[model samples]
Every structure is written in structure tokens, then in C-alpha cells.
Target: MGVSIVDVAAQANVSTATVSRALRGLPRVSESTRAKVLATAQSLGYVASPSASGLASGRTRTVGVLVPFLDRWYFGHVIEGMDQVLRDNGYNLLLFSLGGYRHGKMRRFTESMVRKQIDALVVLTLGLSAEELRQLHRTDIPLLSVGGPVEGCSGVYIDDGAAATAAVEHLIALGHRRIGYLRAGIQDEKNFEVPALRTIAFETALAKAGLELRPAWCMVGDFTVAEGQRAAARIFDAPGEQPTAIFSGSDEMALGLIFEAQRRGIRIPAQLSVVGIDDHEFSASAGLTTVGQKPLEHGKTAAGMLLAELGGTPHSLRETLMPFELMVRDTTAPPPR
Candidate 1:
């Protein structure tokens, strides 16, 4: 027998009506009681029907968002913007989160749910294999992307190479020739669009400026603040000389670098200059010099674009380039004389 609302209500010791309301995320349920009901339902393997939407007309009026991490600042803020738009348009968001980033996972995407569950799909900052993209295409619904490039997919993202180039140029213009870089991990290098383009621009900018590339100064990270701290330890502990400045790929990693640098009593810019991408909310207080872009706008813009297509306003543009700016602040300066 299928797990029904009656079964869930019995196990949760709540009325069947309560189970219905809680499962549908309706108001009037106490937070504690709602949580308990949700846990009980999950434990009982209860599946909710998409009966609320127009499933009969082959339209769910819900957008499916595939994200690598829901907790990360970038993804969270982007989802926030996307949610506001979707909600206002009488649509709901369906999220598929990986919980964390992992390297070399050979999981092929099966888009059967895409056909059954959503009217449109938004892929956020995660890479999709050609085969996976094909699977998604087979569903014949609109596919939109934010923050990363999926080949043959229409998307919106900042110009990564240009942004990285501007950041590197900021360091160079500040007269810091010996600049290091905190780069994305190997997995990002292999599949993701944002990190790979940024890395190329970083290297190209250094070369164009006639600066020497030092292998010892480059650090690989998963673009997290915690990983940035550990990478900093390796930087200071290396046997040879170190670069006077660093260009972190993201603001979160830069914050981590600054935290670790300050912990070791290294005076900002006086001892080490650090610049990062993304002017995260805390960037102002921390005084990080970075190339800033808005992830929120990326989300709102992409979601609106997708909805436009669904609303019979399709456009010919396959990709849109967003904007970025270099914000100079206390964390960077002219190299020590």
C-alpha cells in the first residue's frame, strides 16, 4: 500500500488535515509541530503529489533549480532573488541541492523528473555534462542558467575572464608585481565555466604585464572560506620566498585568507596585499579589495528571462554577459618599499 496522508498522520500523531497542511507548507502550523511532522513524513517515505499545479495540461508552473550547495552565500542569495520572482509570478521553486561539492562524481543526470515536475529549469553555477544536457533537452522545457556556462545552453553570467583580468590589473596597477593567486580546485578546472575562465584571465594578465609566474605561490581551493584558511597556512609555511599580493578567485576565500593572515599578525597590504572577486555582504566591513558582481541580479535576471520565454516572449540571444566592477579598499596597496 502507498504511504498516504492517513498513514503519515497516524505515525506523527497529528490530524490528517495537519499532515496535509504541513506537507503543503501552509501557514497555521506551529514551527515545532511542523518540523516534527516533516521528520515523521520523511522517515515514513511519504511522497507528495504535484496535484496543486496544472499537471493535466503538461505544465507544473514550477521552476526546478539545480544547485551544488544551498548553504553557500552565492547560491543562497541567487536563490533568494529567483524565489522572489517565481513567487510573484504565481510559480513555486523546486530545488535539487547536492548538499556539498565533490570531485569526480560520475552521476549522470536523469531528467525524467524534469518532464514530470517543472515548467522550466534553472541550473545554478553547476556544470552539466554534454550527456546530461542532452537528457535535459529531451524534456523540451526551457533551460536557463546562472553563474556558469553550459555548452549549447542559453544562460546569464558575469564575464569571468574580464572580471579576473580587472582584479589582476588592479594588483598590477597598485605596483605589486609579485602577486599570488588563490584558484579553484581541479574539479572546477575540469568542468565548471566561471573558475576556468577566471584562471585563464589571471594567468594571461600576469603574462601580459611581464610578471614572473611562481608555482609556489598558487593555491588550490574549493572556493570556501575554510579551505582558504588552510591554503594560507601552506602559503606561509613554504620554504622559499612568498608573493607580496594575492588575487583570490572569490570574496569568501579572500575573507578566509585575510582572517588567517591577520591571525599570523601579518599587517594588511603592509605585509601582504589581498584582492578577491565578489563584494560579499561582509566585504565592506572587512575592507576587501575585489572585483564585485551581483549574484542576486544574476538569479533574478535569469528567472525572469526564462519566464518570459514561457510567457510567449522568446528571444534569440543564447547568452547574456553581466557586469562587474573593481572595488579598491583597505586590503590592497602599493607593495612595501
Candidate 2:
């Protein structure tokens, strides 16, 4: 027979209520008592069944994570961090992926989620509309967001404006006057505005540096390697002025530019310079200079905040800015003589 909560409570010399409270991380249990109960439970190999625990503590022991695209590098790593923290804290994960088509899926998921399946929710870089936010609020679940700021949602993310400005300033400092930009083109700026923030900052930095944005060289890469390569091709194949440096919105896109540049025998930093945001896993190996921020850390922090709120301790629901840095690498230098 499996060790039950009754046995654990009996051994710990506490009521089953206390045992449940401690196990569920509910308040009112003293720290010493909670530790004692946990130790006793561990000694007896008492593993609380999720169903039974939910019935006892009014918790589902699960967290729901909503993401726009599961295949993207940022979302995947952030989910990994959230999953690690959730599983370690004796919780299950439920993933809701839009696959980039949120028009229908967003509404449907919001409706279905109010069924009380999860104790809390973590949204990844998805812009929630006012109506959608209201639908989510109807669930009354603790909510947190990762990637960018969302209305009515506390967010954990790097400052897109700062990160982009840094990238542009780095290129400007390298004396690259003829610099172009590879931007992310999300169709709905009203929903997901992180790309727009980066775009504004990119242009702002260039303008502040007294450089004009060359329309011929600026193109949208959609924050993916394949699309980035295509945009790079357009920039190179286009008529008129070619940029000596290009600032890509993401490392994935920047990598594509490098691949395309090399294929065309364009010597990096000599004939063309490249800089990007997001120190993607391949950045170092690929020698990408970028504004680096850890998506995994964003995931873990957001999940931790939601879990704390679920455990009867709520954190500030304001924007939590994660750290970022300029990763200078081999891909950038002064313009060719």
C-alpha cells in the first residue's frame, strides 16, 4: 500500500489538514512545522496524488502555458525553464500553442481555459487583446507573461527598446554609416508589439546618430532563419545603394544573413557587418554579435511568480525586466575601406 497523507500526518504528529497545507505551500503553517512535515513525508515516501491533493487543497497542481509558436527558439527554451520549475515543485504543465494563427485559437483557448483546469497561467510573448484579456481574467487564475508587456498582465522580459538601441549603437560606434535593418514583421502590431518597439528603437538610434534609414536595404525577416536569408537576398540583389552593415532583429535572422553572405562570398565585417538581438544557442559558434538575453530565465521567473501566487503568496504584477548585455563577437567591425 502507498504511503498516504493520513500516515504522513500521523507520523508527523499533525493533523491531515496541516500536512496538506504544508505540502501545498499554503500560508499559516509555520516554517519549522512545514519543514518537519516535508521531511516526515519524504521519509515515509509519501507522494500526494494530484487528484486527492486537488480535492483536499482546492488546487489542480497544474500550470497552463500559452505560446504563439512552439517551434520558435525563444518559446521553447522559456517553456523548458517553466517546466523545470513546475515539475520540481510537484506541478504538471499544460501547453496551449496557437501555431501562429491566434485569431480563432486565442478565443477558443480562452473559453476552454476557464474550466479551472490549471491553477495558474504563463503566457509567452503573445499580445492579448482587451476582450481576450477579459476572457482570461474570468478564469480568476494567477497570470504572468514572458517576452513583452501585455495589458493587465505582469510581464518578465528584457526591454526591447534598450536591446535594439544597443544593437544599433554598437554598429554606429563601429563607424558603419551605411547600415540597413532586417526587421521582424508581425502582421498584428495591436496584439504583439515587441517587434514594433524594436523597430522604433532601431530607427530612433539611427536617426539620433544622424544616419538615414535606407529603404532599399531595409527588409522584413519575420524573425526566422529562412525568412532572414530571403530578406538578405532581397537586400543584396536589389538595385541602388547597398548597406555596409545590417542590424537584424533576431539572432536567427542574423544567422541567415551570415549564411547567405558567405554563400555569396561576402567577407564578414570586411565587405558586410551584421549585428542582432537574442544570443541564440548558435550565436557563439556562428560568431554572431548581438544583444543577449536569456529566454530561459524569463520563463523560470514568470513561472515562479505564478507558482508563488498559486501557493497563496502573490508577487508584484508589474513588468519585471530581465537582464541583457551586448555580446561583441566576430561579426561586426568598421565599414570596409
Candidate 3:
């Protein structure tokens, strides 16, 4: 038989309850006692079973992470940050990807999640409906959100409106009057509040600058390189005067547009200036101007908040807006005379 908590407690000269508290890092346990228990447990190869711990204390020692797409760069980076914190705290992660399926995925997932014993839940960028939110609330678990805000829940995310406005303002400052706005098209039922907010910010910034937002200049493309290339093609093929600059909603799209423009023999920054958001890994190497937000930091902050709540620490349920910076690289310059 494997070494057990009883062995650890006996070796540490403490009661089993004391051993359990020390292993769980509970506050009532003294520092010396905790250290002694940990050392004794380690020496005996004692590994506490999560199920046994959950039976003793109502916590599962596991966190459930719900994300729209695990393959995407933003979600992947955020998850990495959360995973680090959870691992350091001796907790496990249960990932639920809500990407596929035609319908009923969110409903089924939320309903089934209530039966699972997770200490907390972390939602990343997937909007929940009123019924779904109500169901989650019924679970009475510590909840956190990243990448966008959820009503009645604490979250950490960047101000999508401000970031997009900053990108647009940078182009306007460079004397580009006819600027195009390339945004992601609404593809699914998921609440894409980020793109919607960014679009509003783009229009508002243009209005503030006393510049007309041409109907033809507003293009919708999926947040991807291929979509950006296709949108560029459409913009250039139109009969009206082409925009001297373009503000894309994502770095991937911006890079795609730049590649397509170069293929068409259009000089970047000289003939067609471009800007994008996200400051993706390739943004710096490709010399793309963009508004950069830290996805990894957002993840860590959200996870910390959830952990605090779970640990009985006082925390506010308000939305935490992260910071963003404008990276002016070789892609932007003063409009041609």
C-alpha cells in the first residue's frame, strides 16, 4: 500500500487533522507545523488525494477554465498564466473548450458543470446569456472573467474601445484623412462585445477628428490573415478613392493586409500605411504598428482574483481594466503629399 496521510501525521508528531490543515495551507496551522508536515509527507512519498481532501473540506482543489478557443494566441497565453498560478497553489485545472457544435453547447456545458465539483470557474471572452449566467450563479462558486466583462462577476480585461481609438488616433495624427477600418465580422452567437466596442470607438474617434467615415472604408473581415487579405482585395477593388491608411482590428489581419499589399506592388507606409491591435508576436518582427495589450498579465490577474475569493479573502466584484500601449513601428508615417 502507498504511504498515506496517517503516516505523514505520525512522522510529523501531529494529528491527522493538523496534517490535513497544513497540507492544504489553511491559516490555523502554524508555520512550523506546516513546514514539518510538508517535509514529513515528502520524505514518506505521501501524496494527498484530491477526492479525500474534497470530502474533508468542501473544496475540490480544482479550477474550471472555460474558453472559446484554446488554439487562438490570446486565449492560449491567458491560460498559460492561469495554469502557472493554479499549479503553484497545488491546484489542478479543468479546461472546457466551448468552440464546436451548432447549438446547445453553452447550455449543455453550463448545466452539466453544476454537477462537477470545481472550486472556481474562469471564463475567457465567451459571453454568457442571462439564463446561462443565472445557472452559473446557482453553482455558488468563485467566478472570474478575462478578455471581456461579465455582468455581476469580477473580470480583468483591456478597454477595447480605448485601445482601438488609440490606434485610430495614431493614424489621424500622421495626417491620414481617408483611413479605412477593418474589423472582425460577427460569425457566431457568442457575444463578440470586444469587436463591437472597438468598432464604435473607431467611428467615434473619426467623428471627433471631424473626418467623415466613408461607407466604403468600413470593411468586415474575420480576425485572421486570410480574411485580412480578402478584405484588402475588396477595399482596393472598389471604384471609390482608396484609403491612404488602414486600421485593422488585429495584428494577424494587419500582417495579412501588408503581405497582400506588398504582393500587389504597393509600398507600405509610403502608399498604404497600416495599423493593428494585439501586438502579436509577429507584429514586432514584421514592423507592424499596433496597440499592445498583455494577454498573459490579464490571465494572471483574473486567476489571482478567483484564488483570493476562493481563499475567503475580501475582494471586489468589479471589472479590472488592463493597460495598453501604442507601438509605432515602420508601418505608419505621414500621409503622402
Highest TM-score: give the candidate number: 2
Please report, in order, the local distance difference test score of every candidate based on alpha carbons: 0.81, 0.83, 0.80
Q: 306-328 in candidate 1: lDDT tens per residue?
A: 77776656472369888889999
- Cα error, candidate 1, residue 78 (Å): 1.0
Tens digits of per-residue lDDT for model 2 on 1-337? 8888899999999988678667765555788988888888878877665454533354667888888887899989999998899989998899887667645543444656534456677788887766778777665556788898777788899999999999999999989899998987756344577888999999999889999888888898778899999999999999887899999999999999999999999999899999999999999999899999998888888878877776666454557999999999999999988
TM-score of model number 3? 0.82
TM-scores, all candidates, are 0.82, 0.82, 0.82
TM-score of 1: 0.82
Q: How many residue pairs collide in each prediction?
A: 0, 0, 0
- Residues 1-337 of candidate 3 have per-residue lDDT tens digits of 9987788888889987677666655445667887888888778877666454532243567888887676677888899888888889888888877763345543345645633456678888777778878777765566788898776777889999999999999999999999997887765224657888888899999999999998787778877898889888888888968899999998988988998899899999999899999989899999999999999888788777777766756554457999999999999999888
Ranking by lDDT: 2, 1, 3
